[model samples]
Target: MITAQKREESLQDVPIAVSAFSGAALERAQIENPQDIQFSIPNAVLVGNDRFTLRGIGNNAISSTADNGTQTFFNGATVALSPQDEFYDLERVEVLRGPQGTLYGRNTTGGAVNVITKRPTSQLEGFAFGQAGNFDSVKLQGAINLPMGERVRQRFAGYWLKRDGYTENLATGNGIDGREQFGVRSTTEVDLPWAVTGRLTLQYFEEDSSRARETKRLCKAIAVLGCSPNELGFDSPNTSAVIMQTLLRSPIFTGIFPPGGDIYAGAPNPQDLRKIAADYDPKTEGENFIGVLDLSKTLGSLTFTSLTSYSEGKSKASTDWDNADLPFRFLRPITYQLGPDRQVTTDRLLTIDQFTSRSRTWSQELRLVSDNDGLFNYTAGAFFFDSKGRSRFEIWHPAIEFFTRAIGLPAASQHVDNDTPYSRTKAWALFGESYFQVTDATKLTVGLRYTDEEKAIRTRSIVLAAPTPYVVAERDWQEWTGKVSLDHRLDLSFTDETLLYASVARGYKGGGLNPGNAVDPDFEPETVMAYEVGAKNQLLGRALQANLAAFYYDYTDLQLGQRIGANAVTANADAKIWGLEGEFLWRPTENWLFDSNLSYLNTEIGEFLTIDAANPAQSLTTRTPAVPVNLAGNELPYAPAFKVKIGGQYSFGVGDWTGTLRADLTWQDEFYAREFNTPNDRIDGWALADLQARLVRDDGRLELQAFVKNVTAEDNIVSSIIEDALIGSYRNVRLLEPRTFGASILVRY
Candidate 1:
């Protein structure tokens, strides 16, 4: 069963295309993190850790105030932080494809992911699990359920994970991309009077780990000898001269290398994919607290439900934007006397970027759902949400302080630039859906939602000697989206059950401000009109299952990210997408199971003109303008044309223990990382294989397992991005994890 439609229903009976995975299924698939779900689900892609794409629609906005095209939910509540830490202690995960604006209001233009946690039962039960893997990885997880009298129940779950970094920092002699995380959750369920029930849950999570390192794939220093041309058949351009000139003046670089020496000496070897040359071995730290309350009461044939949630989190990070030990330039204003005249000059200082942010969100939802037994059933709901966030970004130049002290002058201010931006969002929505039985075998459903949202931001810069005025921006948006679907059950002699359905839906994502932008700071909302047809079948005495879906989307006013100087802003674009997906499961025998899935996607962008931020005329020094480029007939980012996965499992008996062996192989087609479709933005397709072996006691009280992922150790690039012109125009690529082998033990009581 799944809750893709905000109610309990058999996976095969739902008209929507959804992939559901139980807790046991996750364990078998070795899906230890949210990003792993992309391999198992059709037409779903996760970029980096926070960006998700479905079909061909995705959000690439770098601004914190921008909304995502895809949204995630935890126990019917929208998640405000990264969903990675919530993978543990889950009852099931449901990936819903296509637009879900009818039931899920905003920020669902691509799709929705629902994570449901295990509920407490009126019995005492507990389990403990431990695992150890390569790279000095260790993990421990446990959960306990307790019953307090006949009217109350509670459950507690916690997890701790630590792992060594996968990437090595050559300059700092330290490791990067490591993980150290801890999380705990508590849930309580109480039976109230008058057939009312309430469930309260609280969760806390923290992470203190090394930040991921990016591999530099391109350099823009034309003056440097031995520099090679990139895949675009272009050598370093004159735009890099300004950055090189600043580096030559920095005492920090002069002390290390000869004056006017090779600036590319700190670049990492291109042949080594897992090594980086960053002077700063930065760390990322974050903490989050979440609370949720759910209440429900049944009267007659209708059920009333209320859901409330609150969340707050803070994060700090420092990143090596250059991906090399190169100096970052920061302009400092100074005054000097020349020929008895006062002259003002700007000096370029070496600096590093640091970031800190905090956010809080609260939401409430009230709804009524009628039983599905009647010919006419309906659901109605109202939702309210509010969120606030603040971020502080600074460029600190330690070298400036050192240089000033050496010259017998007042210590230079460490901060060359400091920006603090505060953002807030308030939204409310009303929605209703109804189902009608047109015939004994045919059903028709329709849903509608109205959403009103407001977003605002205030930006302040503290670099100037005098106080600067805050830059404020605000915008409001209203949208009406809905879905209509018709499904029929076929009376077939050869199959147990078969369902055919067709749907048309519309999705919406609200637009927001670009805090510091002086021109066109506000962007327009994006919307998509989707059409789909699907079939779900159960055959061979319910031992075989097959599902197929075909969909087309008309996307308009698509939000796209771009860099204007040092600030990230959003722009509007248009696109069209179509895809076909298929899923199959077969159980040939009691001990054998086979499953496979395939997806084919096609995407094309409508004609639009935008600045090519990666190849500016003159970068850092002068903040030169960038040339505009036309993007037409270009494929969408992260939209693999072809993807397939095949897996099989076999079980056998070994005395008092049951043994199982499983293997899976997945292949994906090449895709681009940007709208430009340049050769440097393309990522080659790759295939991976995973194997697992399991042994369990006959009574199911104990289990042991061994697993290996990426058996071939393929060096695949998972994500890539082009740095802004201010950073010297380079491509940063993130590689997939290398081969890992691990063993696990589980105990139940």
Candidate 2:
């Protein structure tokens, strides 16, 4: 039983810090999406694919309206930054962990994932699945349920996938981050007359990819001068032999150089990272549509609920802004060319772009539940949300439009910039929760919530050589948030179930309009204040189970994110984080099973202010004399200081069929990806292992499975992309995902 509390208790009597999973325990741990459940929880990191960081609080805002702090809900509406593909026919997938802001709000500070789906069942049932793997992969999934005659019911699920491309792009021979996608869902349930009940759901999904593939790490060390290193010496960094001898005495770089060579070459195994030397081919496309509505009524002691939702999404992407696909200066030199009359000296050159986005969302909720078993019990709620979005960018460069048409200008000065933005948001909330049993074994719980928010923005920035377009900005903001909690239930004998909890939470993240600053102004709202303590247990007779938690966070105004040179700004900080968490589950026998989780984190950075995208007049106490960085004690960027997850599983029987085996191990420690902890923002420390085997049949449908993941092909890295070097370090990375093996089959009726 688990709903991570919206009511459905017992997961050892829920006291927070959750991690539920069903759908056959997510297909016996071959978990398919949501970044594979971030390696089974614990400190939960995952940064590059829906961006997450629970214990360390997350949101990496590259501006698309950046706002995240761990939030993703479905059955309770709100799927904002997208990264949910319905996970098949899920019927479970909670995650909870730290701060749920009195029933999910303020993006939960760092928690909330919920996603429960699977309804409509009166009788008839169905299932189907298929799989194939190894780079050229394929998968299919299915579900069905129907029954109309008596109280109605219907369900239908879907999935389809294809994969290929694990990198290998001899420049447009294509094959870079490949995968195709498909999705469908439909659900309906009804039963009226006296007690009332109704449900409805619809979904659709689409994806196309050639997703960005990065790999080019060079951070510093390159003292200029005819930039050397091209002949398979690709540990990258160095390339200026006086801008390649003045671009080979220009004549348009000797008619594009390449026949006697020198278009600023190098890369043909420059330390092969699945090979690359791009010229122009990077991709991504996305689509989504969703809808949900639910209703209930029972009224005797009370029970009334309503939920409504709508979502829309669209995306388009392009990248290859010189991730070393050669074409000139192989590594860095956005600008070059001086002599024999080509002139376009600096201010960086060589860039390519395309980006588009769209979004729409709507939500509504209302609830009132309480059908006690005695000593008070309750839940009350109200919530509403709205969203709208639009974004566009298209940057360009081609020898700076051939040196701005040989220095005459126009032709948009080689089009170096273009932007368009618009955004809107609205929110409201009111909530409550209560429980009290006082004695029989003592019990008490309390909660509260209140939220109000608003945001609006409009922007436009265009500078193809600046002559116009740089003004058309707008901003608006408003906020208020709250939450409080306490829970206790203890009467241990050896623990047959016990819980002790404490809390104080308040979270919010809203503030917008900063399209990389057109005139600079507006980038506030980022708050948090959380403190917690927890314990949950069940022993012996219940086959051991334990959960423990401790937390502290007093983050504020932290909308941090910086890049400066290529413009990606937002700042304001004051952070402090403290953590300790643990979880364990053992079954001993009855087919045996064991689970584990652990985390320890500490992060700090107090009072930080850095929002001078090249001096927007530099006034937050001014600083930035050509790069003077200080973010106090740092350490809050992907935060990872110790993290672990262990696993186990076993089951056996032969003749009539039934067998199982599973394994898991995950580790983490060493993380930084930014927040200016320098050393080029470290990122080492990795461990991963997974394996599985299963077979079943004894008149209970059919099943078969075999799996392997990350087995030891851990390339780690998971996120980075520095960029800011008129001539040397451009840094780029994003790895992980090497070993894989698969097999699957399932059928049910």
Candidate 3:
């Protein structure tokens, strides 16, 4: 059973494409975080830490006012911040593919993910689980249920996790990308006098750990002039020449350059993928709090539901931007003369970047749903959401400050600081859906939604002796999105059950402000029209299950981010995507089970011309005759052409216990990380394998398991990004986690 339609229904009966995982299934797979869920789903991938893509559609821009194309919900309420520690004590997770605009509203052009937690039950029971692994990893998780009275119930759950980092810092002999976090949740349920029920939940999470290390992959000296083989032995683009020329033109450095010199003459390029050299070992910390209230009542054949939620969070991080030893000496003329008789001196500097952000969000939803027993049923709802946040970003060059002061130059030339003092989003929507049973074997469903959203932000840059003027920008967008589907059941002799369905749906993401960009302060909203056909069947007396789906999407006004000097702006583009997916489960015997999933995707960008920010010839300090690069027919980022997953499990009796053995293998094709699809942005295909063995008491009171992940020890690059010319011409690369083995035990009361 699942809630894909905002109501309880059989998974095979729903016409939409959705993948659901139960808590038991999650534990069996040893899935500890939300990112791990993607390996089991078809046509779904996770880029970086927070960027999630489904069927080649996802948000690539990093802006204060922009929203994600794929949205996440916790217990029917939208989660403004990433819930890194909420995977514990979950009832189930549902991933709905394609557009869910009618019921989910905005920011779901790619899809919607629903994370439902276990509710309070009228039972006095509890369980505890513990695990230990390599890298000094330790974890503890447990939950307790209490029956306060005949009409009251309470539940509490929490988890603690700590592990050493995987990446080694050669400069400090320390680890990076470590994990240290803890979270707790409390829920209460009460029965009201007016035939109503109410539930309240409170959750808190905190984390303090070493930040992820970014490996610097710099370009070769010859590559600075054009696209050539870089240190990674790939023809990659860089901005070395543009940055050098910009510094040369600045008045403050009139005579600091030699006849022909390279600024990145001594930059370090580490060869090991899991090792980095940096002068600074940064730390990242954050805390979040969330509260939700739900009330429901049934009157005749209709049910009324109300949900309210509020959340607040703050985070801070500091990093060594250069990823190398500082104070690199360079020869400069002291008397403003180009002759050999002039005195030469060396100057050095270090680069550091710091960021702090705080945000609060609240939302309310009221809905009415009718019973599903009748031939005609309907669902209607209204939603309101509001969020406000502030962020401060600073890039410091301490040596430049001293140099500028000695030369009597402005303080603004020494560093760059940008502060978004205020950023806000307000949105409201009205939606409705209806179902009609055309006959005993046929059904028609339709849904519609209207959304109105507005966003505003104020930015202040170069907060020094002479700070730049504050830029305030605001934009409003309205859109209409909906879905229509028809499904029919066929009575065949060989198949015990069979269903076929087709749907046409539309999705929209609101436009947003650019904060400091006055000339292009806003971007247009993005929209997608999706067409799909699918089938679900059961055979061999319900022992075999097979599902297949094919879809095509028409995407327009796709939003992308670009950097101009120290500022970022948004742009619009178009694209098309088509894919086929299949899932199968077979149980040939009572003690054996097998499953497999396959996906094939094809994506192409529509004809459009835009600036190539990574090109060495492009200027970053000023907006001039912009160089145009056509991106027609280019494949979308993270959209691998093929993906396959296969797994099997076997169970047998062991004295007074049950023993089970399971193994899984997954493979993914190569894909790019940017729209340009340059060699530097490509990530090679990789395969991973995992194995597990478990033993449980016949009464289920105790359980023990041993598991190993990434048995092949594949070193795959999960994500990468090219830095701006001003920040140095290089790429920041992030790799997948290394192989790990662990053992766990669970005890139930």
Candidate 4:
């Protein structure tokens, strides 16, 4: 049974394509966070920190007022932002792969991910676990539950994890992509009179980590260096500096690497993967505080529920822009106005870039649900959300002037840019869903939601010698979306556990104002109409279970990102997609189980026209390349044509212990990283294998496990960034972890 439909029902009865994982399954699969869970789900991927994509649709807008197409929920309340916390002491994680806007609220055009935490128990319970792994990785987790009197209970859970970087930096003789993080959660539950219950949870998490390592992959030769692109190596400062200087002289480097190849000095060679020549290691730090409250009361077969939540998050990061260990600079005199007078100064070798953001959000929801025994069952809810945030980004370098007198300006003109942006968002929605039992073997379901949202943005850009400010922009959006479906129980002679369902749903995502771009600061809302048909069945005396679904989507006003000049701009487009998904589970014996999931998707850009922000006069469609090139006929980015995952688990009994072995393999078809559909955009598909072994005491008090992930050591690309051909084109790819082995021990009382 599952709660994906906002009601307790058999998984086979729901008309949605979903993947459910129990805490034990998560542990066995070695899934620790959102980024790790994607490997187990077909047609799903998480890229670039928080960009979660399902099928062929994703939202990558940088505007604070915008929301992700795939919404994430923690304990029935919206996470509001990225929910990438460590997965410890969790009950389960449910992933719905189709539009769920009706029940999940806003920003669910692609899908929804819900993380359910373990609740306080009425009896005393506790567990402790520890792990050690390669790269000097260490992890610790523990949880305790306490019962106070007969009506009160409390639970506390926390985890601490640390690991050394996998990528080596030759400049400092140290590692760069290391990870360090910790989190804690406390929960309190109370039973009141009149069948009322209340619960509150508070959580705090902090992360201090380095940037995801990226290496440059050349597609064209560098004429200035007198060598083919594949012959270059970024492992040393001297070698990279020479290539950097040569590439800087290329005419295509004008707006991209104007000063020279100095910015790419730290990028490592694709073949080496581990070694990079950088002056400084890029570091990122984050902190999050969250609180959630739930109150529910039952009265005469009716239940009312209220959920409230508040959260605050802050992060700061510093990066070495040039990536090289050497100082690469070509001094140039530029004139600017300081105060009321004109000044001149020579540009220095820009090096370090810093970025910081702080945000807070508050939300409340109320719901009324009717008991399911009646001929009709229904749930209605209202939600309100508000958020505010500010961010600062700056870049500068250290340099001493020797010819400041020759240029007419001061030597302290090292600030490349200083930008501060602010954003505010307010939204509210009313939604309801009802199920009607039309016949003994048939049922009908309908749902609707109405949402209203408002957004405001302000951007401030400051240069070393000039101040440029953009006008504050504000926008409001409203939408109405809903779903309808029919489900029928099949009467087969062999088994009664079969269901056929068909559904059509409309989902909506509100629009927002862009901060960095002044030419076109507003984008449109996204809307999708999806049609799906599916069958769920259990055969062979309930030993074999299978579910299949086919779906088509009409998606419009999709929010996509593209690099224009030095900034990234959000654009709207339309697309069409059709796909098929199937999941199978078989347990022929009491101790053996096998499972598999497969998906096939085909998508195309229907209408994608873009305006050149750098040149307002150019209006080029996605099918016609005028500025950033068109992508009208191109396949959607990140949507592989085929995906497969298969696994098997076996449990055996020993004299005084129980042993289990599990293994899984996932394969994906090649896909593109961008909309341009060029050779550089392609990311060839690959396969990964994972294996685990565990042993538990007969008394169930202690357990031990060992796991090996990516056993094949596949160094496949997960994401990439490509510059324009006119801007010294280059491809920077982020590769997956090679191979990792770990072991852990757990004790329970």
Off by over 4 Å in 4: 81-83, 213-270, 327-350, 397-420, 462-465, 515-519, 611-628, 723-729
Evaluate model 2: give its lDDT: 0.70
Model-by-model lDDT, in order? 0.79, 0.70, 0.80, 0.75
lDDT tens digits, residue span 470-560, model 3: 7888888899999999999999999999999999999998888776565776888889999999999999999998988999999998887
Question: Which candidate's TM-score is highest?
Answer: 3
Looking at model 2, residue 524 earns an lDDT score of 76
Model 2: per-residue Cα lDDT over 219-277, one tens digit each: 33243412121111344444442222343344654444334543334533345555565
Flag the better candidate by TM-score, 1 or 3: 3
Error of 1 at 106 (Å): 0.6
Query: What is the Cα-based TM-score of model 2?
Result: 0.35
RMSD of each: 5.3, 23.0, 4.8, 5.6
C-alpha lDDT of candidate 4 relative to the true structure: 0.75
Candidate 1: tens digits of C-alpha lDDT, residues 215-256 = 434543443212212453222223334354354466644444
The alpha-carbon lDDT assigned to residue 721 of candidate 4 equals: 69
Order by lDDT, highest first? 3, 1, 4, 2
Q: List the residue pairs that clash in candidate 2.
A: 226-240, 226-241, 226-242, 227-239, 227-240, 227-241, 277-325, 278-325, 334-349
- Residue 359 accuracy (lDDT) in model 4: 90
Candidates in descending TM-score order: 3, 1, 4, 2
